[model samples]
Target chain A: MVVDIAPMIVLGMVILTSLAFDFTNGFHDTANAMATSIATGALKPKAAVSLSAILNLVGAFLSVEVALTVTNSVIKIQDSTGAPNPALTADGGSALLLIVLSGLIGAILWNLLTWLLGLPSSSSHALFGGLIGATIAGLGFSAVKWVGTGAKLDGVVGKVILPALLSPVIASLVAMTGTWLIYRITKTVAEKFRNDGFRWGQIGSASLISLAHGMNDAQKTMGIITLALIASGQWHDLTAVPLWVKGACAMAIAMGTYIGGWRIIRTLGKGLVEIDSPQGLAADSASAATIIVSSHLGFALSTTHVATGSIIGTGLGRKGASVRWGVALRMLVAWLITLPSAALVAALTWGIGHLVGGLAGAFVVFAILLVAAGYMLWHSRKNPVGHHNVTDEWEASPEGLAPELPKEVVR
Target chain B: MSQILLALQAAGQVLLAAVILGAGLPAMFSLGMRALAYGNGGSAEVEVEAQPHVLGKVLAYICFGVVIIAVMLGISWIVGTGMGYKLSFEHFLPVFRKK
Candidate 1:
């Protein structure tokens, strides 16, 4: 049965798909901001998520430069003449929509699968990976604007990877210096006071880290939506992000943050390393610094990676702190695979769009996605993860209960 | 006039449709979850403890802020350089000078 679809209807599908991506993005990356505090008993799981949600909203207003970059720089738009312009027809619009939706599905599925297995993966990588994969599949290799790809890659390597690799080292140095200074200056101060002082410091540091995360991570979706709009020729130039776009993206991400990515939180907060108050403070401080700086400069670095590095560095900084190499290794594997995988999914979806043709094809694809997503949600209800169980303990096991810590670590 | 109106109509249709679907569904879902959580009388208290030292906490906050700003600058510099702009600390800040 063939059904005629309107341009407006197609546009609606794309927007919904984008929001779905945003929603998944929120829960997927929540652990980046709240993991350490949850692990160290600094904040209750629910309270931590609530705080992150509010800060994410506030942070979204701070910048739109990154969104502009995403729309204009990352995705190259072409005109009807097939020249490089940002005017898109109904066909191009639907293709872009399908690619984005497929990318989100791939990312959401990967996140859930990883979370179920108690692995802390990079949500930022997952989203990028999905886009890359879908774009490659739909547009083929040539459809990828090599210049934009190259520029983005350079940023990823120099700004994202280098800083991530260095953050822990830098953090350790700063932390060691800070710790040493505290000891030297306050030798006469009581041990209890020293610990108390640092704890208060951690609270402020942790809040900043959460705020920074919102500033950097949420902009990514804004960029994606803008790219879609520009590619379809809805916008003439890469100018300001519309107020509605900003509000919607911010709201979607904030809501996701409120829901929390419990699975990742479990792995990060408890599985990787035991966090004390001082270590939590140090890690959060480092993460906040890296994320905020990256956001200001408009580098779309993964907050997950920076936060993970900080936590690892903090662990190493503390004497005899056990680092779980096995889990860390697993997370690294996911990071390596995210981009290529999502790109492939997008490409395949694009091919399907070609076969179906125009509005009919778009509807067919959208219906399939809805049915599949609905089925997944139904299946997930058998073992759902919700607010009652959105904590480290609940996420530690598949059964929504905390399992016993390993024998050596329990000591 | 007809052609221009047609183009504007197309753009408006697309934009309006996306807002309803993309932003609307998630907002509704989130609101639903929040209502459920509140109905259950969930505690609003954050469980995390504050670090005790005012000075240490202040320093950490300052350091954290500096790092975020630096990273943002670094990203912009890298992207800008790739796009053929000269790399400098000034480029990292908002005060960009015309060449």
Candidate 2:
């Protein structure tokens, strides 16, 4: 019974950490769905987030292809080498639980850090990176299916990395063309006329994008929790996601969305581009299409990248509007770092958790996670970004160079 | 590299489809606005905020109707396939699956 108790406790901790990761994912990506609508005043900030939250709840029921991809791609649930199992696995199911717990811990911290910096990195990649890092620390390179099954490159490279590169490009192209066409077609119309009509269109497109986001992102948490169940010896196969799991994940994400990630919204909506109604509509349309289509293709593309790219594309499509390459460069750097940084943290947490042993180790790491999260929360208070002040003027360096920066680089 | 090519091909399909539906819907809405200008079949100089001509109003409704249908199809596709039993396909969109 004592032997069973430790694994049970670790499993419970893993569930909670997975939920925490889902919560961060909620707030982090809300901007992907609603930022443009809010920026253009098509939807009030509170109403925008509230609508996104409800749609995300409805969207969670959309599909399981991504979840299946995550489970099969990231970690080997059962070894097939015909060799003796490790002592940890042989002793009990605790080893798998520990890996997942450490991975979720890593993902949650990365989510918090990126959220603090207001950088909209890929939460999907963060989650995958955490799992990969923890698997590496726990089991070695052989455990990860790098080249994928049957000598094809359809695993992480096919699903996560390649899609990451292509999604933003596709979104940008679509958005740019959309913006140019909208402008050209409506050039004869009054500015107020076109702008007013597009505002209502922007709301619809933004809502669809939010629904698409829910369909894509909430599935990640579901996959991780399913992994937990399998690793804990509760579920035997990578099967259908149970109903209760779906409800819990959907609710967690909706709650988080309602809370809203105002800082990141400010970054995407205001900092990246001074979005007009048409640009907002174009961006949202691009995001909805890219996300929906990518998920349909079984690729876990980050909605953040798509939204950012669409915003940039709109700026480029319009005459005399400048893309803030400095901010864009910063965002790119953050995206590059997201996977490895999350992995490093996951690895360290995994090592620390094991060194102390059993439930106590998981508890210690959870406490550390709470402290790290709390500190980030407090640190953000100093900057104080919210719906009220999210539309304030963008300072290129946050240092406010006093009206000299725009002529410094922009055309 | 072949895997990369395969992924690229799928991306091309996504781009095309997105353009037709994603970008196209907003363009339809724009066209709807434009069509509303000729409700009286006069010059296309009617102010957008002004009252619309009946024929132009019907044309606007047709454009919006196409947009609504597209959105509904997208949702049903998500719902039918996402619940994991209504449809199955080896790639992208799905073919009907019984049970």
Candidate maximizing lDDT: 2
Question: Where in model 1 is the C-alpha error above 4 Å?
Answer: A1-5, A71-75, A78-92, A145-195, A231-237, A297-299, A371-411, B1-99
Q: After superposition, how far is residue B51 of candidate 1 from its true place, in Å?
A: 22
Per-model DockQ against the true two-chain complex: 0.02, 0.45
**TM-score winner among the candidates?**
2
Question: Model 2 segments beyond 4 Å from truth?
Answer: A1-3, A62-69, A78-91, A149-153, A236-238, A395-411, B38-52, B85-99
Task: Report the C-alpha lDDT of model 1 over A1-411, residue by residue, as the tens digit.
Answer: 854445557666777777777777777777888888877767887888898888777766554455455423233343323233422445556556666666665666556555554455667666655655666666665555433222332323333334334433444444333333333333333434434545554555566666666666667777667666665656545555667877898898889888887767777776667776666666666666555444444444567776677677666656677777766776666566555555555556666765887777677767766776676557556655554554445335735433222344223
C-alpha positional error of residue A221 in candidate 1 after TM-score superposition, expressed in Å: 1.9
* RMSD to truth, every model: 14.1, 4.7
Candidate 2: lDDT of A157? 75
Check candidate 2 and list the clashing pairs: A62-B82, A63-B82, B39-B53
List per-prediction Cα lDDT, in the order shown: 0.57, 0.77
TM-score of 1: 0.69
